[model samples]
Target: MHMSPVRDDFRRSQLAIAALFFLLGFQYATWVSRIPALKARLDLGEAQIGLLLMTCGVGAAVSFPLVAVLMRRFGSRLLSVISALALGVVLVALSVVPDYPLTLLVLFCDGVAVGCLNVAMNAQGAALEARYARTTMSRLHATFSAGSLLAALLASGVTAFTGTLAVHFGLAAALLAVLVVVARPGLLTDDAPAAAQDGPDQEQDGPDQEQDGPDQEQAPAAKKDRRRFALPAAATLWMGLAMVFGTVTEGAMNDWSALYLKDVVNAGAGLAPLGIAVVSVMMVLARIFADGWRTRFGDGRIVRTGSLLAGAGLALALLVGGVVPTLIGFACVGLGVAAVTPCVYVAAARQGSDALSLVAAMGTTGLLAGPAVIGFIADATSLVWGMAAVAVSAAVVSLCATRIGWPAPEPHPEPHPEPHPEPLDGRLAPDAG
Candidate 1:
């Protein structure tokens, strides 16, 4: 049977959105894989590098308000494309920036672009789910992990050939440009809230109903004002907390896994990058099947179980204290927490766009800043302790998972009742009740 145009559009949009996710992950991992090189080139201490990361986080944290406004004005589609292009430009700038201050400025800009893209792309994901009534966010996130895996492998390969940031990041940026162009047309244009597009129709409302027109107009404005200052619900806060903790575990590993291998395990330069590769590989594999698990087990059970697995597994690995065990632990962490953020994002989207934006921003902060926090911890104590903190964060995610209200499983449709036989008489039969 031939598919309708709408079906084709949906498929295209889905692929396009997945590409956006992949783009973000690939760009991010390219830089993240080079953290060790950056530290050495800048001749920075762990604490100083942490401070640099903190700057990026600060930029991301402060960007939510601006991102919110931009989303309202431009809609998620345009904003996603624009921010993605900006991210590519920022990556190139990062490669060329010479001084420490200039580099920090570029990173701050990168953070802003990242924050905007994160919120915008996730909004698109939520919209896709709403329109299609499917659980796709997890699979979309899997593409992200795939991108990271590719970047890690590429970084390793490129390092062997040459150690030039300009060459590596330039190639990554070119790839991003191609993907952004390919994905833009397929992104959903009608992603804005329905209320925003439902202009007053004079023909629909009779003269008698005109009296309520002003009130109807004022209602949205009042709602908007209230939303500006309103506090998040307890459930929303819990979800955000889970996101923070979940991302802290994820982000810390992305930034520090190599260093942990190099410094703690003495894995040497050749093997250090594999730490990130291991996590990305496991994350990609787990996320590939996470949506199916969510359908069967529900988001709550999956999150709680996964978080516990991640925390306990990592903690055990640290205790074992060897390169092989540590790599195994990172893989566990990846597999266990792979679905947490996507589940949390789905739950937050159900709350409304405001909560979604807030939670996404919080997650970005965790992803960017959490690694820096680990850096400071490593400086003050040891890298092992810093990784222990990641384990603790994973445990906290499990705790928060228990508290937050997850979406209930969709109820099965009931079977149609059998038709009662017509009464012999002309009159209708009496009700059983």
Candidate 2:
């Protein structure tokens, strides 16, 4: 079991992770973007919808780490399949369930499934370079954002043509059918009960690592425990910060964009999709090339720079409030956040491929934590202030990234030999870079 050949296998594994993100995207896009439509069907007010949205964070918080531990213990392949199927079923429930409380309950379940799926996907993505010696997490997350953009388009399309919940729900189900097929081959990785047997030490390392030494040209068991999570730690903080800023802007667009446009900008319901979908477009484009920036600059510096831009964008939106400034603000924020999650998780993988699960879990917590805190603020104070809170959070994220990844991890051996030489250009970990 020399790990030198695993590089190709790990790269191949990335496609599976991408498809998983795509599937997850199909659901999440609807959650944020479909509010106006959902409000019509459910006939709910702002506060109630806010409460329902909050439930999602609660459900996600509970489910993520549990799934991370399970995926680490059991295996990504199995847990992911189960989680995906459950997510689809719950999505259908979200579309049809008219009862407000029932909808919240179902959304909770959806969050649980999505949270679990996220942990499983990142654990797998991190393993690509973590076990193989190359980059994978950033590209995989780029795919994740791409999937979200795709869903944004799909959502707009569905809204335009039919404007029916049944049609949208059916589309989700159809997408899941394709996802199940694509995900099946990967699911087998988790079917065994082997997870229970793995001790905490083994579980701490996300997946199997059959490699050796601190440098290339392989052998065995100089297995570096490499617990200095500083790089990923910093990356994780920035990621969380990005989520806070991005989600607020995102939440605004999701929950209020249409309303704002309809009321403030005096636009019709149909055209209001521009507010959210436009940002999605920016994010999709940015993720494709963001790594190049990170490679030249560093994740820490880039993220901080992005945060400042995102915060400035928020200010622009707040101050200007007109269509052009608002759009620019949204675009800036989208571009700022586009590459962040990928950068962070990839940093985690680089630290120790074995620790991918733990690091991914920790990283996802930042996502979960930011929303919960913001949701409470939105619930208590005004929504505008809540958004301002997101800006502050991003600034805080910038500070945290600086602290988390300094004195980067010691260099480790290449886990495998590759057809291509490893790219010498790389960035600081996501948080600190």
Please name the candidate that would achieve the greatest TM-score relative to the true structure. 1
lDDT of 1 by residue, 1-433 (tens): 9976656766788999999999988988888798888888777789878777777777888787777677767888999999999889987887777778988898888888888888888878866655554567899998886888789999999999999888888988999999999999899886654313221221233342366675675565436524542766677688889999999999899899999999988897999999998988888888889877876777888899999999998999989988899999999999999999998887765555566677888888788679889999999999999999999999999999887767554342121122111111111111111
Show the colliding residue pairs in model 1: none
lDDT of 2 by residue, 303-366 (tens): 6677677677866786777776777876777777665566555544333323344444444455
Candidate 2 lDDT (Cα, whole model)? 0.59
C-alpha TM-score for every candidate: 0.77, 0.66
Name the regions of candidate 2 deviating beyond 4 angstroms.
1-11, 30-48, 92-101, 149-171, 184-278, 312-329, 348-388, 406-433
**Candidate 1 lDDT for residue 67:** 79
Q: Which ten residues in a row have the lowest lDDT in candidate 1?
A: 424-433
lDDT of 2 at 133: 42
